[model samples]
Target: MPVWLIWFIAALGLAGAEALTGDLFLLMLSGGALAAVGSNLIFDNYVIDGVVFLVVSLLLLVLVRPALRKRFNSGPALPDRAKALEGKNALVLDRVARHEGQVRLDGEVWTARPYNDDDVYEPGDHVAVVHIDGATAVVAKVV
Candidate 1:
């Protein structure tokens, strides 16, 4: 195959692979390959082809990436609600004896305790999920 055809084929292949991997960097490489093919076809000069490919690759990766990602991620099913739950209210179900017990948060049982504080609590106490310290919740009394 011709150099331009080879470069175009490589560009399509790289673009497909980038789509499969879900990474943005390979898209720049695909842009570079396509730019090389086009520039070589237009000018047929080694230095100008290289320069055009470099400029196009950098422009695609830097200027277009954030917009592409924003468009790609724009949807109603965004996972922002999970982040809102931090510092939310919950209720202790078991004795927070020595800073350890189970709590009921939105009807789900979660292991919780006073976060970063040395304190004791009891059942039926209201607490706030201050933070998550791994599998357990670091909660404190909501007063």
Candidate 2:
């Protein structure tokens, strides 16, 4: 039938396909097709409608898609697991020396060591996790 009608149908099809992928690309093409429908209505020329479609689609893909994707994808930033434990109190489960020890942190047992090689903590003493080194917790006496 009319060129505008064909473009309108293509736009509808592209928008429907966009639901399956959820990537916004086909939705951008659908936007272009709608622009083509408008251009065809105004000029009734196939060449002008095609050009309008190309330009609008490329503009949406390059300019709008990234901002939309970023907005959709971004959320609250969470702290790293190791970093979250720093400065938290722990109970010394065994004598904590520079070389080796054990502590209860957040209800879980963790391998621990004193932050200072010269420092030592007896079992039942309170300590704070200074930092994590791999699976081991580097700690300091709480007081």
Tens digit of per-residue lDDT, candidate 1, span 68-92: 8888888677655446667889888
Quantify all predictions' global Cα lDDT against the true fold: 0.81, 0.96
Give all candidate RMSDs, comma-separated: 3.5, 4.4
Instruction: Predict model 2's lDDT versus the native.
Output: 0.96
Q: Per-residue lDDT of 1-143 in model 2, one digit per residue for the tens? A: 99999999999999999999999999999999999999998999999999999999999999999999999889777789999999999999998997889999988999999999999999999999999999999999787
User: By TM-score, how accurate is candidate 1?
Assistant: 0.67
**Clashing residue pairs for model 1:** none
Best by TM-score: 1
lDDT: worst 10-residue window of model 2: 71-80
Instruction: Give residue 37's error in model 2 in angstroms.
Output: 2.2
Candidate 2 vs. true structure, TM-score: 0.58
Q: Report the Cα lDDT for residue 129, model 1.
A: 83
Best lDDT goes to which candidate? 2
lDDT of candidate model 1 versus the reference: 0.81
Error of 1 at 75 (Å): 8.0
